[model samples]
Target chain A: TQLLEQSPQFLSIQEGENLTVYCNSSSVFSSLQWYRQEPGEGPVLLVTVVTGGEVKKLKRLTFQFGDARKDSSLHITAAQPGDTGLYLCAGRANPGGSQGNLIFGKGTKLSVKP
Target chain B: DAGVTQSPTHLIKTRGQQVTLRCSPKSGHDTVSWYQQALGQGPQFIFQYYEEEERQRGNFPDRFSGHQFPNYSSELNVNALLLGDSALYLCASSFTGTGYGYTFGSGTRLTVV
Candidate 1:
């Protein structure tokens, strides 16, 4: 009963390619966050999206939150080997729901080859 | 300033033994939360400590317990450890009121034999 489902659990792509990772859930969230983790390190926060149907861009990375607040996506353009890592999507339940606890997805493991 | 800090980066224990892992929250943070991540799995929330009290808990059993010190540091204790307890234990720190923008430690890898 995973609260959030992430698609393409594992991905391998060459440099300069583009890829998108999806995180879907049935329950609405107050906010969603994206993180990147390398081996032997804790996940690092990339961005946080709170408004429904909002899109945010960070250099080559683009993040979008669904209008219903139940899904999110991460798109990387011209991906480079430096983008290789585990991409995790975490959703924060609405207030008074789960005490606003964060629910995490299994994550998408990405490998960008040179 | 130092981020969250976890002790005993790695540990190996035998079944039936008790183990304690420690964490120090980031500067100015007042709340501590613990999470367990199994191999190839996402982290599952264990519990959160705020104002030296257990604020929220997940579905873990009684075998798992924790404490928060006045300085906002936390300790996670496991009683009667089982082989299945092997996993990476993470500590995240954040402000109590905001409850977001968590700062996570590298985590302690625990292996129960």
Candidate 2:
């Protein structure tokens, strides 16, 4: 079974601080997706990275896929209180093995206090 | 367009009882997948349905079963549930060949007593 390991299980920071969360794995994936989930709601997709060494930025958040596709990271710049939530990383295996199933990381819970 | 939708929003059931959860895929989506998320844990894949058939399943037990309809909606049925079965059950929908992200529903919170 494939497993994704995420770091910094919990994080707390003041507003305007920067934080980075990491997700690592031994298995390579066809693509990796990042999601942010608020309390009492399902996860919402933030971004998807499909290539090695790929970097995608959305406003204050920057996401990077490892060169080997076995790891990824999410960095939030000038974090605000609204950025507080649980961040999850999910990996889709290469096709033909098990299609449409996403292996997920335990996730990092971030709390940004004003 | 509306994203994935799941009902009922919350349920309470006794141990050993059977429960069925339903999901309607997003517009233009043809695949539906189920997941279980325990408090403070990531969601675990339960299974995926396509073309009214279960195409893939996770390591869950036989007590966990599902069915898909022609309209791409799906139902997850759990029999003889245990307290451990209590969790947030999420439904996600995606197109068959789209490598994009899957759209997730708000999820049904199942509490097994």
Candidate 3:
């Protein structure tokens, strides 16, 4: 079975700290998506990276897809309290809906203390 | 436009019972997908519907079923619920057949006792 393993399941730091969350997989993906979920809410998409070795930035968050398209990462620069949330990385499987559903990582829960 | 919306923001049910959760896709959406997310975990795909037909499904059992109406709204039904089923049930909507992105609903929180 295909799986995405995320690292640093839990992270807590002061408001000004920076951090990076990693999502790795042994299988290639057609696309990779990053999402953030707050308590009691569904995950909201933050970005989608389809090309290998691609990087996209949204405000202070930098997202990168590995050169092999088998992994991805999210880097938060100068994190703020608002950046505290559960960060998730999901990989889209080709032929995708059935034999390959979006494989989701367990997620990284971040807590930024103000 | 209104984003995706789910009904019964919260529900409490007992094992062996049945429960139904509703979801309405965002405006202009044509496909719906269901997911289950346990505490502190990412959402797991349950099934997806397009053109009012089930086009795809996940690793869940038959007890977990769903339906998509002609209007693109959908419902997730679970029979003989188990405690492990307790989790946030999220519904996402998107344009199908083109591999577009999805917009998710707030989710129905189901706590199986």
TM-score of 2: 0.97
- Please, what are the lDDT tens digits per residue for candidate 3 over residues A25-73? 9999989999999998888989988889999999999999999999999
C-alpha lDDT of residue B72 in model 2: 95
Clashing pairs in 1: none
Supply DockQ values for each candidate: 0.50, 0.61, 0.52
Tens digits of per-residue lDDT for model 1 on A6-98? Answer: 988999999999999999999988989898988888888898888899999999999999999999999999999999999999998865322
lDDT of 1 by residue, B1-113 (tens): 99999999999999999999999999999888898988888888899898999998888999999999999999999999999999999998988666456788999999999
Superposed by TM-score, candidate 1 places the C-alpha of residue A81 at a distance from the truth, in angstroms, of 1.0
Which structure among the candidates has the greatest TM-score? 2
Tens digit of lDDT per residue, candidate 3, span B55-107? 88999999999999999999999999999999999999987555546788999
Pick the DockQ winner: 2
Selected candidate, larger TM-score, 1 vs 2: 2
DockQ of 3: 0.52
Which DockQ value does candidate 2 get?
0.61
Q: Give the TM-score of candidate 3.
A: 0.96
Tell me the spans in candidate 3 whose CA falls farther than 4 Å from its real position: A95-100, B97-99
* Each model's total of backbone clashes: 0, 0, 0
